[model samples]
Target: MSVRPVVRQLFRIEQLVDMLLALTGKEISRLQQILRSGTVVYHYYRYWWEGFEAVTEDLQVLLAKFPDADPSQAFRAEQCTAAAIEQAETQAPAKKMEVEIPREAASRKRLLRARSLWECLMQLAHENIPAYKTYSYGRHADIYVWEILPDVRGRLEKAVERFAPRELRAPLRRILQSSGALRLRFFVPR
Candidate 1:
């Protein structure tokens, strides 16, 4: 009941809160990747759907559980992020969807996309976090990315310098900033 003990308890609680925030951020991030990939309702639709629902519900429950916390702003920010992605995908013209590229070219384009996707995700995690405030611990940076950030970043850097043809390298590095979009339109099968 003394001042020292009260401060000690408060410090300990903050540490616990930070860890919880990191874990929650990481979990929601994983869900976002699944949702972004359009795989939630794929072959394993039921399983992913159940898990996604649970994670989304956990967000609502977290709000209720934290009495002093007002995460309305964060929730609204998240909604805006989702809306932005929706708008970007829907606004593109159907005619633009058709394009012709070889398999070798497609692979390069995908690698470009992989790097772009990684960068976009990291930026979002760093700046435009969708979770509750004070929880942007960024502990989920390397969580599920098949290739690590540094490796992808390094490759992207090298790709910029290594490719001899401007036509080949220009589009990849011209990175169009988006939430989780890989705008590889009209990649025709060879």
Candidate 2:
């Protein structure tokens, strides 16, 4: 094979990578928009999960192409942009989960999925992109307070103890404290 063909192929691959990066950035922006929109709808839970899957797929393609292309800056920029949009669009009152989140077992399942997706996104951002400082403090703690805490109110300590991974205790306690909905001692060690 002539050097000319090899060079042409390399240029084509580079162009393809650039296109993929741009498309992925757009996907990330849309995902952020979905997050910033408002209360997590049951239907939207699947959407959010799918969005993360798309972003992961894009990241894989990017890594395959460059192996060193840090798209972290792109992700960070989108997060900021989404936050600004969210702030501007915040004129409407937050819709309470009472109506949106049902107490049924199926709804509870979806709610857990939503919480998992939130954690997954946070982990991705923390590891790959810049951290959102509020995430650790209780970015979406209301879900837990409104959904899980209510079911286990009488047995708060026991419920919290039963919760696995053990990392969720302290922040959850802080959220509960700040919320003023319930007063319970968090027995889990910090």
Candidate 3:
């Protein structure tokens, strides 16, 4: 439970993004174990916060590249209609059912959007956000992530609403809002 292993695992961009985007109950429980096992270093907390900020900023840039109208809407509407038709067909006795495989951005436009988003996300590993210096130092204290990074949660919401793909909007919000990641904040004392 040393700080180095914890930092290497948690502060990594790909791992962090995956944690944010695909957090599970099991993962949260594990993260809780990590948090409760060790005293979190102050500088590491700043690094962790900056990781989240980088994820959000990179997503914003990718989303800005999307066309004004979200291409996913049309596909979503088609899917709903297809589901209704399928449900009606299912009610009829003894029909052979055809399985529908979902495509993640099958069309060229969608593929492009997806690719750009991927690129932005990959770039997060290399990007750095300059941390502002804080002169005041106090006794070690545990602080809520939202409390210390006040406006960041709000910014994350705005980015999701404005730029996130239609499918990702809900899960991203739910996971980040309720996951163990938010509980990882620390206020380091010198």
**Top-scoring candidate (TM-score):** 3
User: Which residues of candidate 2, in runs, are more than 4 Å off?
Assistant: 1-151, 182-190
Q: Give each model's whole-structure lDDT.
A: 0.33, 0.29, 0.31
Tens digits of per-residue lDDT, candidate 3, 1-190, equal 7554434444543443333322221233443443344333343352244211233445445334322222222111212111000111234447423222122321112333434222322122123221212211121111111121335445545544554555655654564354222221212222
Q: Compared with the true structure, what per-residue lDDT tens digits does model 1 show for residues 113-150?
A: 44433233334334433444332342221111111234
lDDT top scorer: 1
Candidate 1 regions off by >4 Å? 1-90, 93-154, 175-180, 183-190
Q: Which residue pairs clash in candidate 3?
A: none
Better of 1 and 2 by lDDT: 1
Better of 1 and 3 by lDDT: 1
TM accuracy, model 2: 0.19
Best-to-worst order by TM-score is: 3, 1, 2
TM-scores for all candidates: the values are 0.20, 0.19, 0.22
> Residue 185 lDDT in model 1?
17
* Candidate 3 Cα outliers beyond 4 Å, as residue runs: 1-120, 128-155, 179-190
lDDT accuracy of residue 145 in candidate 3 = 17
Better model by lDDT, 2 or 3?
A: 3
How large an RMSD does model 3 have? 21.5
Candidate 2 or 1, higher TM-score: 1
